[model samples]
Target: MNVFEGSAGYYGRYRPGLPPEAVALLAGAGSPSSRPRRLLDLGTGTGLAVKALLDRFDDIIALDTDVEMLAIAETDLRWRLPAGVRLSLCHGAAEEFLPPPGWRADLVTICRVFRWLDRPAVLARLNQHVAPDGAVAVLADRSLWTATNPWQQAVRSVVQDFLGPQRRAGSGVFPATPEPFGQTLRASAFSDVTESFVPVRRAWSADGVLGYLYSTSFAAPHLFGDRRDHFEAAVRQVLGCFSDTDTFIEDNTFVIHLGRRPA
Candidate 1:
């Protein structure tokens, strides 16, 4: 299966275990009443963040490159959308999606999206969409399940080796560090650059973790190929060794960045 196909179920099913810092950063963008009458959600995979934004903004535009992802989002939104909320989904990259003339948004949000973007181009395009006084916020989660724990160090090493090539080529998406990413934001015309880190923990049953692994398009080949059964069995054993309980915890860090266009 392709990346989006194999991975859809995982990201599509997993709920956003948003950290408080992320919430605060979003709130800092503007209060609901003060929020831009117009808003945009860039890389709105499955519309999780879009749903949250809708609570504050009555007019919204969401863009995603994946058509299937948008389809899933549309289904979810149909059920929970509030009255007066309007959403338009654009099937294209953030840098390419054009709003109407004199279009300007009060707020622009890119949650867990930048890792997949061309940093420079996206920053420029995002700048263009925001009203002079508007704010743009970007959020990303750094997966540290393997890196932080001494027991998981070996697992981290193995996973790193697996993802090494993709990381080098910037193909894996998402940055492992925030320094360089923050630098790009700083170099832009945006002001009041503030970033906060929030720690999150997710509990997963054995099958759930297995499903998550299989859902990764990059790791699917390793998890579901000739060694499929073997790999799953090994995962069960490794997780079992790590936990005395039926579930395991994924400890991660989410970083939120907030900046504003010049007024």
Candidate 2:
């Protein structure tokens, strides 16, 4: 659930490759000249989202619980950020941090990491930090649409063949659909709660597909242990059927739910 620690090295590897909704949500949140004076990126991971925020905010603070992830985030900022942008990297569970009394922020965003917690609780927590008349965006990708791709049969065959009950019992790739998730936010005191979906198609080669899966926690045990070769072989067998000219299309659906903090 700690995406910062989970997706460390792979962070931002797919840059310029994010879902369209992600870009749109960022835009809807506002631009540099008009962006909120203060921005909070919860569960920031390696800070890619926050990096974008930095372009807007004169001061930005990103917090994550994983030390390893924050370490990399700090290094990335030093190496990649332009001068004059104030950045602070805090290490701790996001829920543990409280905005100072009477403190409210212009923007509060959690991208790709909010679904890991109990939805209602997290929404309530995020709502507490938003400035009145301010906005919040919770960004997520629904990976289950991969089932619509031509290769779904093959990939499911292998996963069902090897991972069996685990696949069913463990968390499925996508979290809540757009509607229910938005309702959770509405219930937590956000007004004008609206959900928008963006469809993004990511095309990757056979090896790229396997690499993406191997990067996941579900696949890591098999990817790093005795079954590593076996798992790779199964993935390759399914993906290798594609021609070099052919690309595997993964339907990356991002749901953006926005609400205004009541005045």
Judging by TM-score against the true structure, name the best candidate.
Answer: 1
Error of 1 at 112 (Å): 2.9
Candidate 1 deviant stretches above 4 angstroms: 30-32, 144-147, 150-179, 215-217, 221-223
Expressed as tens digits, the lDDT of each residue in 49-106 for candidate 1 is 7776567677788899878788888888867768877788788988786887877777
Pairs of colliding residues, candidate 2: none
RMSD of 1: 3.5
TM-score of each: 0.82, 0.79
Worst 10 residues of 1 by lDDT: 165-174
Among these predictions, the greatest lDDT belongs to 1
TM-score of model number 1: 0.82
* Backbone clash numbers for all candidates listed: 1, 0
